[model samples]
Target: MSATLRSIAMGDGTAPVDMLAALFEARGWPCSADSAEEISGEIQGSWATYQVRCVWRAEDRVLQLLCLPDIRIAKEKRAPATELLALINEQMWLGHFDIWSDGGMLLYRHGAMLGDDGLLTLSQAQALVEAAIEECDRFYPAFQFVLWSDKSAREALDSALIDAAGEA
Candidate 1:
């Protein structure tokens, strides 16, 4: 067995994986446990689809929840994407945005460390999903600005987060 699998086996007493799967199901998410260490599903948002995944870290009792935008960043867009992600991540309390080096896949990621019992409460799990989606919705337009409109990273981010009307 792989090291990841072995650690999970060590955590069998708390059943962290089972808890994660059940949490997703309870929230009406289409979750897949095809991978013993991860549960993933698509969350339908009014604006776009957020692909959400939860990967369990057994020994540490941490569950990493990731939300990825359906859009792919182009080669020329990677630098701007990285800058925008950095700007967005700075303001986040729960998670941060990341771009994959290989495919330039944009993601918003966070983790919850379960207590000694190593299980998530229904409310806690729901909060994770809610927070991820909320952050994704808030920051996605900035990405679009950089990807489609050729806006500079700062310009895109400014347009996304700034409330011009609030300036007196």
Candidate 2:
């Protein structure tokens, strides 16, 4: 970690959620802190604009981050979406994609334990947010392929991964 991150994580006494808010502000990203425990922001990715939310659970000493695209899976497409989510999740090292049963909303979810201090280092918080966005952006196109283009889950995932690898 850099000296600034060390100081922010140790000396400033910032809560995990507040740290996220501060990080977003420093990046000049628009965000809102709905409460002491939660912050929501937006980020523009190559595929789409994503909604990012960070929630700090004081009781659990866990910080959760979620990144969601603007797309919604239709009821009939949920099966393929779920399969694509599973296939995509298996390839991810940091976060996993999930579809909400209630709303058919698909998102990438990740959590980090803050340990005894109940604080997140600036670098750690930044990584969590970045990982979420990266995963969502990477798979957004596959999701479109599966849900809208009638591609099989495996085919969609394969195409997305191949495209990503080529770009990288």
Candidate 3:
């Protein structure tokens, strides 16, 4: 099946956090302080490097990823943020997931495993990594990859926030 891609630019006066919360709630995903705090930590940590943030969600066993770019920075730098977001957008377009954005609100994207085909399969994960690497090469160029996974719901929520940033 072909992937679905949707893009919405946040005009202004939108809070990424509030936008993300509403999106997740609208989709019936679980939202809690623990999850929010964890995602906040991840976003804070990533701010020094990439100017985007992202989040991941798994509801009723379906996985969804959200990305939010730092628009101000992206508009200023242009290439790095745009290229990185495009790569992720490509992943969504390939039937890899769902994507959208709200006014200055966090950009949002999601992926759910409707079947084995919809999941980010091993190959898809590899592709995601490669895409990220390519973007890093053009931007940071000296960045390194580190594998980390949180098997808790916190991980899912945090991922959603980071993904919303559209950094990786």
Candidate 4:
């Protein structure tokens, strides 16, 4: 940890906004934190551009990141979207994809516990953001396949994973 992070982690009464800014700075990722609760920015992925939002809850010692794309499921395709989310989430070990059925909004969400006794350190915050972005980018194409094509959830996910591996 850097000296600044060490000081912040030592509970120097730093604001969550400052801590978040520092965290992203340490990781060298650009962000905007004009609000106290969250930071919002665009993360460029291999296949897509995601609008990433990082929310902090200091009272609860928790952080959440939501990666949202332009993908939206039609009303008739809600069931398939739900099925895709289930299939995708099963293979995921950290974050999970979710659908807002009524609004047809799709998002990849990850939550991390900062633990009650400790400060939300720079490393923990960076890890949470990294995992959320990685999972979101990796699975974005599968969600697109399910929404735009007639592929089944299993097929879409399998194809997406194969493509992701090829990229790696």
Candidate 5:
């Protein structure tokens, strides 16, 4: 399955987490609730699975939105960063222009960064995240988001919980 990356803006009254899930569900995409205690959620659909994780910096009031396909099929489909960069340079998708990967994670940008173009601001990042999630729902009809807790150990425990949930 193919997935896109983008950002979103958090609004008043609605926390970022709640607003995102509600938006997806409104679009006919099934979404798990905030899962506030944990920072992630696994959204399941008939054909695909999506994992959305919100890494928040409470002291800075910032959040890093991450969404990826649970299945790593696209790893083979992915071109090298140089080739991906060329595609971005040629095709331009509104806010998305930069695409690269670090370790196991793929990263993209929407605005300008430092002196480089396509760096996303905090608000832009949030919007991009929301947009990416929406796009995934549209293109990959059957997708789910797997949520995780903040602490690494907690995330591991949550995974175990999910495994146990499935066994039951």
Candidate 6:
């Protein structure tokens, strides 16, 4: 199994964000902790380089993973993008995609609630990060279709959801 799948438990004594930093380190993804509560990393996806941030909320005992794809919607495209976000979120199982209202940046967000002991397993962390990336990668083309092409939100979603039968 990969390092990310190892059954390591965090939060025995160390902060959960530290555990995330270690996971990013193991993946060789450059990451840094701005404070004890948060760490950010860069992950390369099929469509773009994603900026991932893991934030630990000690008070709520929650860990949130935010993944931002390298796409920014123009002001005029915001309406269509918002429409697409709602459609995409409806199909999501774990995380949901949103556009940063002020900046028009596309991002995927998911949160995990830690146990009473504040322990988080490596697989949980891996799942959080991987799910965000996967969702962002999967929907990126839809955002592009809405923002850059002439496709409407529904059309873009339909186009993005198409599955390939075989490799070329």
Choose the strongest candidate by TM-score.
6
lDDT of 4 by residue, 1-168 (tens): 667766777763345556777776665667899588888877677677778887878778677778887678888888877898898889889888888666788888887766665356555666776787788778888888887887898888888888333533
Q: What are the per-model numbers of colliding residue pairs?
A: 0, 0, 31, 0, 31, 0
The list of candidate 1 runs beyond 4 A from truth reads 1-16, 162-168
> What's the candidate order when arranged by decreasing TM-score?
6, 2, 1, 4, 5, 3
Model 4 residue 59 CA deviation in Å: 2.7
**Over 4 Å off in model 5, which ranges?**
1-11, 17-38, 44-47, 71-82, 89-130, 135-168
- lDDT tens string, model 1, 34-112? 5777888888775698898889887898899889878788788888888887877888888898887788788888988
C-alpha displacement of 99 in model 2, angstroms? 0.6
Error of 2 at 162 (Å): 1.5
Q: Candidate 1, clashing residue pairs?
A: none
C-alpha lDDT values of all predictions: 0.78, 0.82, 0.32, 0.76, 0.40, 0.83
Candidate 2 least-lDDT 10 residues: 1-10
Which tens-of-lDDT digit does each residue in 23-137 have in candidate 2? 7877777999989999999988888889998888999998888888977889999888988888887887887888888889888888888778897767787788888877887
The number of the candidate with the highest lDDT is: 6
Compose the digit string of candidate 6's lDDT tens values, residues 59-135.
89998889988788889888888899999999999978887877888888898889876766667777888888888
Ranking by lDDT: 6, 2, 1, 4, 5, 3
lDDT measured at residue 10 in model 3 versus the true structure, 0 to 100: 24
Candidate 5 local lDDT, 44-156, one digit each (tens) = 53345666665544444444555554433244433333343353335445433232344334322332122122123435434656555554443231111222122232233
TM-score winner between 2 and 4, please give it: 2
